[model samples]
Target: MVHGGFRVWSGSEPDFPRQAEQVRSLLGAPDNPALLPPQFVAAALTGIGGMLITRSRADALVDAAFALPTRDPSVILAVRHAANRPGATRLTLVARDRPGAPDGTLVDLPTDWKAQESVFATDSIAIGEPGSEHAKQARQLQGQIWQSPPDNLYPTWLYAPVCPASMSLVALHGDRVVGFLLGFQSQPDRDGTTVLESQVMGVDPDYRNRGIAVHLKHQQAIMAGMLGIDAIRWTADPLQAGSALLNFGRLGAFSRRFLPDYLPFRNELNRLPASRLRIEWTVAGEDPRTELSQHRLHLRESVVPGTTCPIANDGPMDLQITPGNPLIAIEIPSDWTALQQSDLATARAWRTNLDDLLLRCLGEGPDQYLITNAVIHRGRVFLLAEQATNNLLRLYS
Candidate 1:
């Protein structure tokens, strides 16, 4: 095995024939002299190093390493290698299969992958409607105390008073509530100048890849423009990929503060380490209308109700189209609170099964769909779809 990108030697180099015999025995290759070459042995060792270091290897190696019965072994191996790397911090990547390819499947590196950390995005906060199911889910997962007569349960209202006015939008999915833009109406230093603040944002364990949080923030920015918020400000965890991508790569939200564990509530509230990040958003010259439009369109397409297979019986589904083969969407809840507070072994077993099912469906065809917009209302999940060629597909509940 290679270590730190270098090969280790146990003793003097063994003769080619002897080593070749060992390789044949281990890998089940033929022992014929003509069947093996000295160069081939060298190449095999080099390939192993490449696989360990750069994680660049053939599909056959993936199959051999993972021993997967089905599914794309190459992609799976790549993800596994990336995920298992020592000292890895986060992993963020948009699903390659999303209708929007490279642009859509935005992935951050090791920082965002940690099971304990929660992410908040200022962008998501701007777009989410008050009192939506998405909002309720976010609130519940955030571990915030919920006050209720059971019927008068508006979680958003709980945070409304303390939440900044510039933060007209907020989004919560999975276990993290993200996309909070904070600002005040008047400031002594800059009179009449509006400020933008990204108060908090994150992805729940179960809701990472669906892009629900990102869509929420994009929508919020658009809403800010319309509402004449003028400016936006927020903070991020400097070590996170999603934060870097959104603040620097996309919106150009500049970092203004760098203190260790700046957000005290975050540290006291959760078990993970915290870092301070402050950003400012200048709404002027930023056109968020297009982003808002795309987000709404994608949100409509992705949202699905029900948490498991055989779509639950619930409210009206907007669209429903079955492909040539039966397509099913199973919801696996992996939020931080759920994982931290529940039976991990059982949850993992369920997750593995669900992932297997999803991969199977993906292999079916381009017609296969994974919808995230389905809302769970009254103990049922709702799904939406439209028909395809030669199939009477309409929105089914």
Candidate 2:
């Protein structure tokens, strides 16, 4: 597969390292390949020098003894590559932009140069309101990503008008609108505080995992704070572990409500039941990582042996509600996509079971539970929830 000018080849064999060596030879490795360090190729490896640099400069020949650029692209050969798992030997012929400096800052490259060469560099993306010039593109992007019927989409004019309570943020890559978030101020609550109800947000499939969505959300929160809104609320598919990680783990959001069949859709993206977890991200709140650590500490002190419920596909779910134990851990598939592809029936079962489980645990009143953190440990994804308290909401109020 080719990704941003980097050609990747993968294969599994009993002797994968030998295969990697043979592939490197076929790809024109020098007779005496130079022993290079992992830092040159932006990888972390242990125990002395092991990476074999077959070719340093692909376009032009450079002296083998000369000093190489600190983080330049090169034709790297492999044998038992540390990055890949066992039995899967991979080779990468990369022709992308050079790595950043040691201090974690991008080198000053021209805009055109970066646009033409960089793979995941998001500096070229401009985040702002989609004025009249790009409102149509933003609408089209949203429809394309969501795959919603034309009738279900918002009218183009709805995005053109300027409203104080509503804000539309779009991520622009060059002239193309690649990502967007549409939200409006919610009615004042009993506490007389308002929140921005972020109704919908999406990023281009080709430009994902590049921090576009995170940037858009951060910008939305900043804008909401400026408008005197203290929090932003949104709903997400609980089964989507990536979104769960971003919302609860990276974005400092918490969930206390679960909606079963939130959208009565059976589309390709939305599986049966279409359950969602209502997430509330405080515009100004303590770091969720710190809070999660504190929760773990509390759990470590108070958790019993039967507090965690390990979800299994083949059996019925019997959630254990241990009394006097405030913390509970629930497991979900770490790789939802893989699970769905391999066993869709199991995936659906997980959805229904998880819906019933969360609905009961996250219900209203004093016995309700709140999801404080989501974590991926040892290839398993888990949600850490604590029983609701009077002052629990104040953390992100």
Top lDDT hit: 2
Q: What is candidate 2's lDDT per residue for 281-363, written digit by digit as tens?
A: 77875553766447544654454333353332222264655433466667767766566667889888888788877887884
Q: Model 2, stretches more than 4 Å misplaced?
A: 1-122, 287-323, 335-342, 364-367
- The residue pairs in collision within model 2 are none
Q: At residue 26, what lDDT does model 2 achieve?
A: 41
Residue 22 Cα positional deviation in candidate 2, in Å, after optimal superposition: 67
Task: List per-candidate RMSD values in Å.
Answer: 21.5, 22.2
| Number of backbone collisions per candidate | 57, 0
List model 1 lDDT by residue over 1-397, tens digit each.
3333322221134553354334333333332211222222332222221121121144222111110000111221111122122222111122212211112222232211112222334433223443333445544544333121222122242233222222434454333344332222322124544333334454554445656555655665665667565665554543344445455435534432343433323222223334334455566534446553354345444544333234411112212324442324333332423442365565344334433333333221355442212233344322222212122121110
Worst 10-residue stretch by lDDT in candidate 1? Answer: 62-71
- Model 2 residue 174 CA deviation in Å: 1.0
- Residue 128 displacement in candidate 2 (angstroms): 1.0
